[model samples]
Target: MSAINKVLFIAPRFHTNQIGIVKALLNEGVEVEFHVLIKGPTEDYAVLTPIKIEEGKFSRFLSKFLKTQKVNKYYAFPSFFEYFNTIKNFNADLIIIRDPGRFFSIVSTIIAKLLGIKICFYTQETLEIEAKNTFRYFFQKFYKTIFHAEWITPIGGTDTRIKKFLPFVVESRFDYLNETSAIEGYSSEKAVAVIGKFTARKRLIWALKLAQEFDCKIKIIGENTTKEHATVYQELLEYVEEHNLGDNVEFMCNLSHSRTLKELSCSNFFLLTARNEPASISVLESLSVGIPVICPLECGTSSYLTPEKTGYTYRQDDYDDLKNKFRRLLVHVSEDKKIRVECLNSSAENFSEQAYINKFNYIFKRE
Candidate 1:
């Protein structure tokens, strides 16, 4: 008998989460295929065997218009014809979509229903954000239409956002664990790391100001996503230069996932000042490396942070609160190494990679 060639994943981007899931499925002897529907080129990752759907200029224009009108235009377009052809060619038994908020998932679902294929929708964002308007309402209805699968998995702390809409399925998030045994305490010189695209929502400028106030060395890591954000990046650079914070603030652009892990391994703290974050994988990654994360309360991932334990959470947009937290951490660093160890232990216990993999396997096996 042939092995169960079980799952296919659809997404616009490939990141650590996708990489982890594919690795897990392969280890279980399950055949997996990735179908990406976007107008861009693809990156080469070792495990993600991606099937890229190239879009013409007209399709790209329409996709941009839909996104601007509302987030749900991703569902109403004709992008799924290509996706359906890809799925049919692959003969996949299970279809796993990364974010149902996109139009491709809506189209994929319709094709899956007609073909008698099971559909599993995975989202990392809150249902509230997904359904924030009328367009999203229609998108949710579209999701209900193709949600004929045995499970629905959401990775993060925002499960409550979707609990009311889809009550009869399994849910889970990415798990993190400290894999290394090198326990180095924070040095007399403080260090902070912020990992994410340099968008306005990431609040990189605020982090720079806070770094200057606390006399801490802050490393900003990520690429600029759009030309619109170029001004913000420039303004941040100007601020760092004007204040003579060249020594304290360092901007690192577009590091690979492995290189990012190495940076986090050496850092004393993780900094996330996102004005709005559905769920941050960066926080989980930080915790996995036993590095404490400091984030604003508005972030969905802040729900997992325990003050003075796993990390610190401050009120959103309050620069003073951030400064106070940094000040407290500075004091702790100077007075006690034991406090840092306690923080590391807490993060390791809660966010282990094994825990995440086991949960994913459970969801995949659900009837």
Candidate 2:
């Protein structure tokens, strides 16, 4: 019989981004399956129906204890024999885990090895943020040793970023995939948009300042989801009032993904004031619409920025530098619709559905 040609994805939920990967695998005659913890509200992909797993009691106990110790919570722990039975029946050639938790990833890693199946894990953790304690350090070491699996992340410095914790893996093994889609072109209206949580780290206050000084129509997408966020949001509203920026800026909070897209379409440029952003989906989404962005260097998504095509990156937290860069980008935005289209096309080229499919094909074909 031919070699096994099935792939399985273990995730908390399947989002729109994963749909393309599934479709690509199906087009290539490879079977795709998803083992998810919960189904996403908008997960209506036709390629595969995800198998939802119930939480195990041991997993919950471990999760509570780990939380108290300041550790990552384990989200994927199904009944022992039932999980084993499911994997055995699927008999996938390759298995990919999304946001690998300590216990869940370790368990799945062992199961894959026993089944003689290749494993891949998606991670957003970067080495820049070091482990705070010995427990965390040892946990990472254990996971790395047991999994020894392929890591898929954004293209930037993910390889170097994970080096301090996972030094054994070769550079070639890193699969950088930031999924982006094609969108209709929109002309620059000299309006700017910012989308992110209203947390202190995101530096919305800086964006508020930009709106005050820059004198542009700025729209912020996000709501206060936490107590900390509510405090920040309140402060932002006060700043708008004190600075008389009420007319220039608007906070479009709690919007659905489709509505967010609609808001992006109505603007000319996107702005990111994050102090420590790790690969922002909002930045990629803005670029998908052909709207250029102005982000600080600390933002991981800035790696995708090409001064000649996409957008510019300023020094993090440097108000002067950010202002200067924003001024320059504003000039570009006012030029022609073709320039915007070109940037949008460039982003699509960098993170297209076909590119995502090709990467999976490479992984599946590898020895």
Tens digit of lDDT per residue, candidate 1, span 30-107? 688876654222233866657666554566677555556443235343455665676788787778766665666666
204-297, model 2: which lDDT tens digit per residue?
8888887778777788987556687789899899999999998888897777766776677567678888886766766666666667788877
Name the lDDT of candidate 2.
Answer: 0.66
Candidate 2, residue 220: lDDT: 92
**What lDDT is obtained when candidate 1 is compared to the true structure?**
0.64
Clashing pairs in 2: none
Q: Positional deviation of 43 in candidate 2, in angstroms?
A: 8.3
Task: Tell me the alpha-carbon RMSD of every candidate.
Answer: 5.2, 6.6
Q: Which pairs of residues have clashing backbones in candidate 1?
A: 74-103, 75-103, 155-173, 176-351, 176-352, 177-352
Per-prediction tally of clashes: 6, 0
Model 2 segments more than 4 A misplaced: 1-5, 12-30, 36-52, 68-76, 99-101, 125-148, 157-190, 223-228
TM-score of each: 0.79, 0.77
Off by over 4 Å in 1: 1-5, 39-44, 56-82, 127-146, 150-182, 224-226, 333-349, 364-367
